[model samples]
Target: MALLDRLRTREATVGIIGLGYVGLPLAVAAAKAGYSVIGFDVDASKVERLYARESYIEAVSPDDLAQTDHLCAWTVDFEQIATCDVVVICVPTPLNQHREPDLSFVEDTARQIAAHVTPETLVVLESTTWPGTTEEVLKPILAQSGHALGRDIFVGFSPEREDPGNATYRTQTIPKIIAGDGEAAQALMEAFYGAVVETVVTVPTPTVAEAVKITENIFRSVNIALVNELKLIYDEMGIDVWEVIDGAATKPFGYMPFYPGPGLGGHCIPIDPFYLTWRARKFDVPTRFIELAGEINTNMPAHIVHRTREVLDRAQGRGLNGAKLLLVGVAYKKNVSDMRESPAMRLMQLFEEAGAEVSFIDPHVPQIPQMREYGIFEGRAALDPGRISDAGFDAVVIATDHDAVDYAALLELGCPIIDTRNAMAKRGLPMDLVTKA
Candidate 1:
């Protein structure tokens, strides 16, 4: 049967790569939509959890995972790609040391697919990257299979719009932005994605879809940088930036609220915007606003560290050196165990560099995992919030605001409190002892 016909009838064997956050939820969603799903990951532990019916991502419920286990299969083997009628790549595109687009993961996955992909199969790249990556990079690698695109095979690009902690949208609910290399690939892309998501928005080509994703992140990065700068200016003038934002947000049409934080976090906001910044360098185009936004956000953790030291010295008559500090949360955001590009790691390093000892407590993230920038803290476990010692602790910093934390207890410790998220103010707590950083 033709790939499009098989896809429409829910007879397609969907293969999803890199089953971390995006791929796992997509795998489960495909299975729930009555399609056979094969989730591929290099992490053996993830495969083991799949067999055990355990879900590592919050977007995928454990009960839903257990129910989908009958139709969904997970493995580390790439050889099974031949069995799939539709293959979707959902890998990471992190930045390199010099902060350029690291397309290594996408290139490696494309090579793997090229080795085992069969005729009449549809391949979609869901990883965020440079605009031309789908046609300019992936298509050439896929052509190595000796199958012509829009003839013997089909390929496309669909940027992932995954909001990890969002309560409103799921894989099935969010609108899917899809594009293909050509007309034949477009039909197949529509067949597969239209079956899985509530809405499928098809664009002219992969470049348009990729650009849409980049523009979205760029909007966020620039706005966040604006607010972070405002926070600094307002702090100097003794005006509450949060109150100003709240008042501005009351005007219905003109203003959309973007909150300032200790720093930028999550996979998309901190990293994806730079993909454009790096690509623009080739054309000699200057992205001054975006670059300034990146600089402001990047320096926020350092600013926070300096502010903490100043607040502590004023309140305790001592400095950061030789002080014991506790961090309220370590995850990227509230109520989620995602810490990709979180600012807490940078804060820890800065505090330690200033001769202060730092300990973190996150209800969601139990232990720090091995990250590229902060691997030295791999085995460190989160300190129990309830059992915190008041003897040596000089101050507590609220980096992330999870509801599970007992903020009142931190107040009881009789130390300076730096509220970066304004988590305390949101809860109607007194701001007397809390210093808004």
Candidate 2:
């Protein structure tokens, strides 16, 4: 009741862990809602940028950061967790080498909160993870805080619904799904999130909320796989899958359009399905459809490479063994800088393995930062746009279609191109040298 009182009065200190795409926006929204916000991240650079009133994520602007100057604080210190009334974990929940759900970031964050948390503080996990992780994983760890679970320490799960680079929806606009361990936890979570977001949809348990998040992504993965497979089939049959989908879209009943791409990229759709697959195995249930979709999506990059090789051979009479390629976009999605699992990295790896040289140019990604899975190309910079004409590329592969790119310039080179996202055709560019992969 006291925690709810602080939340309703805007006197609560909201601590957000992992100030990336999800955390920063939520932190800003909560601060705007009149709560004192403390953003915690191990990346000191992010903290520095936040303190400088600069935002790295496109969703949060510099003006938004400036507006929160009075209420928002950024820090790399977990010791500051002791002073907060509410702690929300928004860290990455990526998969390990074997494609198993890796909760190391969430676990480490929970440990830090457990070490410094005070009595009667509310804690919630906003990171996407397997069902039951709140009660099974987070509560046991937070129990070490020397406080009662439901009485002194409240734990809950509120899955993040962050759509990077989306102009229409934001953290405060997207309907939030939340669940708590106890009745008190549920009420506190509702009071906290209801103040920050436009709507709060509470489920009976944390596991259901967890499923809600993963189900949203799994639906996307399956739909994307269906379209990708259609792309392959239509490509072989000399039909444009994009055209078919476009025509089908006009009917507007019993059909939704999901376009084909080079591969599944971004943090959610490509990774969240596996979390369910791994968890389902424990129950002796097999998610064959999900696993099949994963397999289909996983092979998309290779299919693009094969098409590039075909273009190289047809135009220049050479294989990919010694081709030079300029990848158009490397960001996981268009118009966004976040590339947690961009398939472009895998394409780079595959191109090099086939003896081809890969250089990428993305308006969103100026320099390839060090990634957890793809570290070999760390610190690699994007190609200079001015040099594209005389860059001597065998084929240009458009992986992501950011609007800022000059697709027309590549046409002047008279070089063959592999168009994955149908960016060229969509722009009314001639298909003389363009091959849709």
Candidate 3:
């Protein structure tokens, strides 16, 4: 009841850890809801940018930063978190080298919170992780502070649904799913997010909330894999998979269109499903659908490379060896600068191995940032239509079809084009020049 009163009165200071894509918008939303927010991140540069009223993430604009200037403060000091009445953990949960769930970031954040958390302060984890993480992992860690869970300090799990470039859904509009360790914790979390977002969905337990997020991603991964497999099967039969999908869309009742691209990208779709697969192994249960979808999706980049080589060979009567190619849209998706798990990296490696020189053009990403798995490709070519038309390349692969790229101009380049995204077809390009891969 006291927590409810503080939240209702907007006297609660909300602490948001990890000011990346998810945390930044959440902080903005919380501040807009009239709560004083303290944005925390380990990266000093990010903290500096926030303090300077700058937004590094494309989803968070300068206007958002300016609007929340008085309401929010940015800092790297973990000790300051003790002053927050509600602390939300929005850290990254990436997979390790062996594709195992790496909970180091979450664990480190939990330990830090335990060190500074006060009694009756609500802690909610918004990172996408496996079930039992809130109870089995976070609860035990917070207990080390000698504060009883749901009694002295409250805990909850709420998965973040942060779509980077989707203008249709913002942090406040997207329905928030929340679950807590106890009734008190659940009621407090419901009121907290309810004050900020348009809708707050409460589940029975934290495990159920975790499973809900994983289920959504797994559904997308499986359907996308199905379509990708269909693309391969139809390609051999000289049928256009995109046309088939269009025809199937006429049904409109039971069909949800999941487009096939070079491969899956972004933070959630590719990685979150596997978190469940790894957890299922603990009980000796087989997650065949998840494993099979991962297998097919992972192989798509190589398939795209093979198709590109075939199209170039048939057009110019030469192999991929020593051929010059241009890749359009290196970012994982359209209209965003996020490059996590992008298939373009795999395609670049394969093109290099095949003795082909690959250059890329992305309006959103001016310079390729350093990635953990892939080496940074120095120098980005301008996306000028005139420059692309004059550049003599053996083939051009549309890896990512951003809305900014001129598809019509790309068709006039007078080279074999492998349209992996089917953007050329959608733009009414002549079928002779554009080969849908």
Give one digit per residue, the lDDT tens place, for model 1 in 281-345: 88999999999999999999999999999998898888999999999899889999998999998
Residue runs of model 1 more than 4 Å from their true location after superposition: 389-391
What lDDT score is found at residue 239 in candidate 1? 99
Error of 2 at 421 (Å): 0.2
lDDT of 3 at 177: 96
lDDT of 3 by residue, 145-164 (tens): 78888788999999999898
Clashes of 2: 0
Which of the predicted structures, 1 or 3, would earn the higher TM-score when compared with the native? Answer: 1
Task: Give candidate 2 misplaced runs (Cα > 4 Å).
Answer: none
lDDT of every predicted structure (CA atoms): 0.91, 0.92, 0.90
TM-score of each: 0.99, 0.98, 0.97
Tell me the TM-score of model 1.
0.99
Candidate 2 vs 3: which has more lDDT: 2
Could you give the candidate ranking by lDDT, starting with the highest?
A: 2, 1, 3
